[model samples]
Target: MSGNTARRPLRADALRNYERILAAAQGAFAAHGASASLEEIARQAGVGSATLHRHFPSRRSLLEVVFHDRVEALCAKAQERAEENEPGAALFSWLGDLNAYAAASRGLVASLLHDGRDTDLLQQNDSCKTMITTAADELLRRARQAGAVRPGVHTEDLLTLVSAISLATEHPDDEQAGRLLDIAIHGIRLHQHQRAATNRETPARFSE
Candidate 1:
């Protein structure tokens, strides 16, 4: 038998390594916040630290990649939800999922948000932020039209829900997020009730 050995493709291994690194980094960031070490990332990924450096070069670079990937995913999800027939349901579903997505990003989001506007990834067109907002707005509008969600529900409030969830999910319990979301949704729906009570507390005054 001729002992001819075919060279295994580095591309396949490289791709696999990249995927593993991302998975490990994501878990590490969520578990330990943004300051988690690259060594630990490599350990979780089963790759040497040298391999991590080879792919990411620097911590900031890896962070930017993670943030960019998360934003793109959110945009895609928004688009998919918008295409659904029920806009309000799509909006709520996407809003809930987006919080999950952002929560998953953990430290990555904080880094990206703190970046200056001049940063490439933070530029207006670079991040899919506008597109996602637009998609979300359309969904909210349709839901309002259908009388499914509260009227005069601005997109910003739905946005606040995602941000709230992101901040609230720091605790480990997975159900904490859903509870936070429910609280937000309930507040939005009962906003008028709150305002009415506030008005009632104020004395009726007439200038004669």
Candidate 2:
């Protein structure tokens, strides 16, 4: 899921064009929100309008590809962080990455959702939504198993939490994002002593 499954193998020349289009599109979206000109994108990619449309028939199609690539990159980062010795540290770091991605993706994702089919691409099989959800599930499972996270914290909760952070920190020079992340981490975590106390309390009540 992390490896960009949205595209199949391409011939060398075709692949070049594909990569060029993606690169150009990414830059354009970053610079001009999601409504950037497709003609300008073709120009930047050094390809014709026909070539661009051949690869991505519509603006929504191109946006889906770009978002897929970005999600793939984030999935890669989540995989890397999952291997760290400290489960809590790894989860927090990945959460920070998620927040950053969400913040940058604000406008672009909105545009995609405006068009129904493009939005479906993200939620459909083998799409970015699946990739991100799988990664978050794995990371959360690991953190909980390591006794760092509280029981019953779902992957959706983590994503939703970060999404809210991104929205709240949309303005320039906002420091609340990091502070909220810290708060979220603490909220989801179970201190060792807290777990031990809970265990003791449960047994005592059952024994009585």
| Count of clashes, each model | 0, 0
As a TM-score, model 2 comes out at 0.75
Candidate 1 segments whose C-alpha is farther than 4 A from its true place: 1-10, 106-128, 168-172, 186-208
lDDT of 1 at 57: 90
Per-candidate local distance difference test:
0.68, 0.79
Show where candidate 2 strays beyond 4 Å: 1-8, 46-50, 112-127, 172-175, 192-208
**TM-scores, all models, native as reference:** 0.67, 0.75
lDDT of 1 by residue, 1-208 (tens): 0012232455878878977997788777666656678999999999999999987898766666665555666777877877874765677788788778767765544644555432454453443577668767777777766656654568877887687677867656658887788777765552556556544563344111
Query: What lDDT tens digits, residue by residue, belong to model 2 across residues 74-128?
Result: 9889989987648877887899888877877776656666644456654663667
Q: After superposition, how far is residue 26 of candidate 1 from its true place, in Å?
A: 1.4
Candidate 2: lDDT over CA atoms?
Answer: 0.79
The C-alpha local distance difference test score for the whole of candidate 1 amounts to: 0.68
Q: Report lDDT (Cα) of residue 114, candidate 1.
A: 59
